[model samples]
Target: MKHWRGAVALTISSALVTGPAVQVRANPTAVPAVAVCVASVGCVVTVVAIAGVTYWVLSNNGQELRIPVLSYTPTPDQQLEDWEDYVWADNEQQARRKCNLLAEQYTNQGGSLVTVVRVRRASQRGSRWACTFRG
Candidate 1:
């Protein structure tokens, strides 16, 4: 039984070694790299290209932006409470920092002391924080 199995194994090995070359069809066009890239890398590349093109279009047209700061100074005796337009910063922390600076400046200029009532981010390339001041 062992001898028969060994003989069968030997015959199979010899046949495979001596067989005609077997060609693998990775893709219809036979470009292996293209096929692999399309399957894996191409999707990411396509997404990035689309994003770049979108950014370019918006940047060239100056459309990717928020109108920014509806009214610079709140009316006398009225602290600007309506948010969404005043704050322009990348994050809340930065917005707070900027708001504090503006408050200090507003006070230093002989104006009544002001406080940061609200902070909002502008819609443009996306880093402006509009800080609303209140006394």
Candidate 2:
């Protein structure tokens, strides 16, 4: 049985090694020029899209943003006077730090009880009143 198996394996291996040469032929149908052009354009567009997305991600990451800080103090006549200022910083923490410094400076300049009323993005400053006296 072992001899028979060895013989069969040898025969199969030899047959495989001496098999007829298989010829591979290119497709007889020619690819349309328009299809080729379209494929090229698609690849270019994909590359461009990937590059654009990468650029947007890197450029916006840790980018300094314009933050609007609204500080207010009470006037002598008991009216709340508001002041809008822009803080350019990378994040909210930095903006808050800068705002605190500004508050200290404002207080030192004889402003009474400077309070940060609002800290928001500059984009949300639509139709917002600035330096106004609010009661």
Candidate 3:
């Protein structure tokens, strides 16, 4: 708008300079009619320009930019809950079978069977299996 203001100033300066009523004012007491007409026209133009600028500014001020919302769903591995389950098998063969069954269960629940080992139960007479899983 600096260029626009320059144009406005140029217009007003030209109007003041070119107004023929200045030459008609040969007597000191005479009022120049053409100069009043030019000045009034320039004032009207300035008022209109100011009004146009105010309208443009006000019309653009309230415009708002809206960004879309984003949503994410986790993968099966990430969706899996924490591991906290067990399996008990009496013999080695049964322990292996139970371990496989537990592995299947873990996979169904979105988990990975990381480790399974035989451990002796302190209060029991036989050996048992301990399984660990992760997701």
| Order of candidate numbers by lDDT, starting with the best | 1, 2, 3
Give the clashing residue pairs of candidate 3, or none: none
Stretch of 10 with least lDDT, candidate 2: 1-10
Error of 3 at 115 (Å): 6.3
Q: Compose the digit string of candidate 2's lDDT tens values, residues 1-135.
A: 011111111111222223432221111112233123223422111001121121001112334222111222334476555577766665666666666666666766765656565565565534322221122
Best by lDDT: 1
How accurate locally, in lDDT, is each candidate? 0.40, 0.34, 0.33
Point out where model 2 deviates above 4 Å: 1-76, 123-135
lDDT of 3 by residue, 7-54 (tens): 212222223233321111011112243123234423211111221121
Q: Worst ten-residue run, lDDT, model 3?
A: 51-60
Is 1 or 3 the stronger prediction by lDDT? 1
What TM-score do all the candidates reach, one by one?
A: 0.34, 0.33, 0.28
Root-mean-square deviation of every model: 26.4, 29.1, 34.1
lDDT of 1: 0.40
Clashes of 1: 13
Clashes of each: 13, 0, 0
